[model samples]
Target: MSSTFETVAGIMSETADIPRETITPESHAIEDLGIDSLAFLDIAFAVDKAFGIKLPLEQWTQDVNEGKVPAEEYFVVKNLVSRIDALVAAKGA
Candidate 1:
């Protein structure tokens, strides 16, 4: 797995109490990992803290409302990693 994915997995594993080995790029956090809305928020917060970049929570809602990402892909590990990678880059600039 990529380092970003590894970081994300670690965060999710701790935040959601999931086994790290089960987290995959393709894992559907809500459906597969039993992550409910509150857990998702916790995971998001953890992600924000781990990377030292505030995730654009409002923008995520906007993206969902604007159809930027299909509902299914929104919380996928790889997709979330991509979003974090973008923010991580921006923070360094």
Candidate 2:
């Protein structure tokens, strides 16, 4: 899991142009990462490709865009972490 997080952070740093040190489990996707909508989409695609798990960005955008994320806005890194957590939990490994 730690390795996964590191990989995720690397991806965000490289692709999203966010600083690697800016990422942590506690970092808010929007507030801390500063990712806009298009960046969010790019992050989502990158995460899916890197982790080999398909995150449903369209549905996620609909929910998060409508202010349903409970954070009042979108946060790409946090969403990526959530998706990773869900997929990891589902596998029961």
Candidate 3:
């Protein structure tokens, strides 16, 4: 996998208290893992701290509510990885 993927999975595992071994890039944050809103926020905060990049979680929530993006698609682990990677790269981190 990628370093970003590893870091993301590690953060998710630690923050969400889920087993790292069971987490995959494709894992569904809600359907497969039952990540509640609290857990999702916790994960998002951890991710922001880890990557030193502010995640637009509130915007995503707004988009979801506005029917721009489905919540399920946004909550995928790979999506997090991709977003983090992009943000980090853009920052030249």
Which portions of model 3 miss their true places by more than 4 Å?
A: none
Better of 1 and 3 by lDDT: 3
**What does candidate 1 score on TM?**
0.84
TM-scores for every predicted model: 0.84, 0.72, 0.89
Candidate 2: tens digits of C-alpha lDDT, residues 1-93: 476778778877887798788788677767777877787777778877877676666776678668777543335455567668677667666
lDDT of 2 at 63: 88
Task: Report the poorest 10 consecutive residues by lDDT, candidate 2.
Answer: 70-79
Model 1 Cα RMSD, 1 decimal: 1.7
Residue 65 of model 2, lDDT score: 62
The C-alpha stretches of model 1 lying farther than 4 A from their native spots are: 65-68
Could you tell which candidate, 2 or 3, scores higher by TM-score? 3
Model 3, 62: alpha-carbon shift in Å? 1.0
lDDT tens digits, residue span 8-66, model 1: 89988998899999999999887888888788888888888889989776677677789
Ranking of all candidate structures by their TM-score, best first: 3, 1, 2
